[model samples]
Target: MAEPILKVENLKKYFPVRRGLLGALRGEPQRFVRAVDGVSFEVYKQQVFALVGESGCGKTTTGKLVMKLLEPTDGKIYLEGQDVTELRTKEEIKAYRRRVQMIFQDPFSSMNPRFRIYDILEEPLLIHGIGETRAEREELIYKALEMVKITPPEDYVNRFPHMLSGGQRQRVAIARALILNPTFIVADEPVSMLDVSIRAEILELMKELKEKMGVTYLYITHDLSTARYFADWIAVMYLGRIVEMGPAKEVIDNPLHPYTRALLAAVPEPIPERKDVIKEIPIKGEVPSAVNVPPGCRFHPRCVYFKEGLCDKKEPQLVEYSHNHWVECHLAGKI
Candidate 1:
């Protein structure tokens, strides 16, 4: 098998929940929120591998971990077979940053309100010392902006973030991520903040960029429909664990995990052909706290097919049910 462009193995991030001084003095054991318990996945070159789940399910945390924005409590992140998580030297880390970039969820807040668009896009190149002269830097910035379809870069270059619309600001954000010529990008809900009308355009622009540059994407999102549309492969995460994963169409057309089925049920059906297969809400209850995740199958409490004694007592391991399709549930193949 060809090596993945980016890979994560047993990724874990646990944020300690600090106690009061009195509790500390009492010698209480520290508690930690298991934001990303044990996530494992890979992204092939030029592929959009999406991590989809509801809010607080650790989708965003996983993205941050892959980007090295948050140091992992334990795990390995490899970029082209090199373990970046162990990088120590300043130069090594700098090189890693240049190869990997992020497009944040909010277009409005991700950019600096004070900096001009030119400065924002040029910051990466300047920091990396890529352009020798001012003219060189300006040319690089113009090309990046033009790639994202923000035409006449000169007109927009001097304008501030507040001057651009939500869609245009997001285009700037994409241009910023692309300026460094990154090989991989962790796009955390990049289009969620845009208006419905503009979301398709932004997604299409990203697709074009991927094809043009051969850049791989770790697309983090909560919307299954968007995930299905944007991703080549899909991994459904819950309570920091991947419950199911496979090719995008197979996972969307024939989900096996109850949680995955429930998620698909929640997506509004816009076409008549899918009406017959849309399962009714398969579970009830809000997502459980990550700090105190339920024992056994983390999803049993909310799963419609929860079994007595079994599902609540032992967690299921991820298993392949068909060609390249994997699912984690006791009911796999049986359901």
Candidate 2:
């Protein structure tokens, strides 16, 4: 296999827990929220790799770390085998930004409401010094809009973000990301805010763009259904750790980890024959706080097959169970 376009090794991000003055006076030990605790994944060229879990599972933080928006607490990130953490200077970061971009979840909020669509699209080009003149920039902006299927760019380019529909706005957001022709894009639940009917459309467009432009994606979302459709790989995160990861189809079809099975069981099936056929992988309790993750397996508290000592006394290491399939559970294949 070819080398991965993006690689993250044991990536960690720990945000310090805020302490009030009284607590500070007591000299209590400083605690931290282990948002992204020892996450590691590799995204190949043009592949859509998804990080999926419940809200606050640190998927977004992972995306930000990849995009260089947030600094890592420990570990390394490599872009095309170059250590991304080493690029700290403003010029180096600016150069990296040109090769990497983000497609935010809320398109409207990410855009400047006061700026017209054209200006918004032109911002990246200006920062990167792509086009020498207004005419050249306009041509590139129009081409980007066309690439995103927002044809007749003139019709929408001059309008404000509020004027476009949710789907159209999302297309514009994608267009903005593409304007610089980034090598990797961090799409943070790009379609969660859109209507269900439009979700497939946006995903299809993104997939199409990948084929046409060779852009890889770090797709962050909680929806398993979409991940099954849009991603080539899926990593199930639980309390800042990946519990199961493998090819999208394989993981969805035959989940080894109890947590992965439980997640799949909750997904709504549309076929009449399978409508009530929930797999019923029993899970208990709410997700534990990130500030104090479970001692052993993070999902053991909610897992149905958790063993008393084995699952609670020691953390499980991610191990390969099948062809390219990995699970971090004490009873990965036992269940």
Candidate 3:
């Protein structure tokens, strides 16, 4: 796969839960919230590998871990074959950050309202010491703005975050990420907050950027439809675990895991007959608390085809069912 730009193995992030005063007096054991648990995946150079699941399924947490925004409790993260997870020195982290960039979910929240668009874009280059002179920085800023399709860059360059629409603000965010000329990007639901029509425009811009710049993307989204459209490969996540992964079209057209099938069924279909053909696998009940996960397979409690003994007692390993297709489900081979 052209030597993966990023590789994550058994990544886990656990947030501690403090006990109450009384429990502390009794010496209660520390409890942890497993935000991301043992997630393993790879992003090949220039490939858009998406991690998708319902909100709080650890997709965003996984993205943060990959970006090193959150320190993992266990496992390793390798960037360009270097073990970035253990890099403690400031200079090492700074160098790692330059190669890997993140595009947050909320454009409004991520952007600084106080700064002008030019300042926002230039800050990264200045921090990274990319362009030396004012003229050089200005040139890079304009190029970045234009790269994200904010035409006649000068018009939008001096404007503040409040001056632009949701979509325009997001373009600026993307431009900021691209200014560093990063090889890998973690786009965490980049289009979820924008208008429906504007979402397509932003996604198209990302696709173009990948082609022109050879940028690899870890596109994290709950929207299976958009994942199907933008990603070269798709990984179906459920309860902090990847239930299925394969080529985007193969996964969408012929889903293997029950959770994957359920996600695709929820996506609105255009044709009436096709809609009927797509069975709606109603995911009953809420997602189980990560602290006290189900016994065997995490999805067993909510899975429709779940058998009492097997699914509830045996954890399933991700196994290859066909060429390039992998699924983690008890019924994968049986079906």
Model 2 TM-score on a 0 to 1 scale: 0.97
Tell me the tens digit of each residue's lDDT in model 3 across 201-279: 9999999999999999999999998998999999999888889999999999898898898888788768865666755
Tens-place lDDT digits, model 2, residues 1-335: 89999989999999999999999999999999999999999999999999999998999999999989999999999999989999989999999999999999999999999999999999998988999999999999999999988989999988999999999999999999998989999999999999999999999999999999999999999999999999999999988889899999999999998888878878876778666664654788899999988888888888877799888999999999889999998887787
Model 1 over residues 1-335: C-alpha lDDT tens digits? 88999989999999999899999999999999999988888889999999999999999999888887889999999999999899878898889999999999998798888899988988888899999999999999999999999998889999999999999999999999999999999999999999999998999999999999999999999999899889999999999899999999999999999999889989886677665675569889989999899989999999888898999999888889999899999998667
lDDT of 1: 0.92
CA error at residue 262 for candidate 1, angstroms: 0.8
Q: Estimate each model's TM-score.
A: 0.96, 0.97, 0.96
Residue 255 shift from truth in candidate 2, angstroms? 0.3
Off by over 4 Å in 1: 271-279
Native-referenced Cα lDDT, model 3: 0.90
TM-score of 3: 0.96
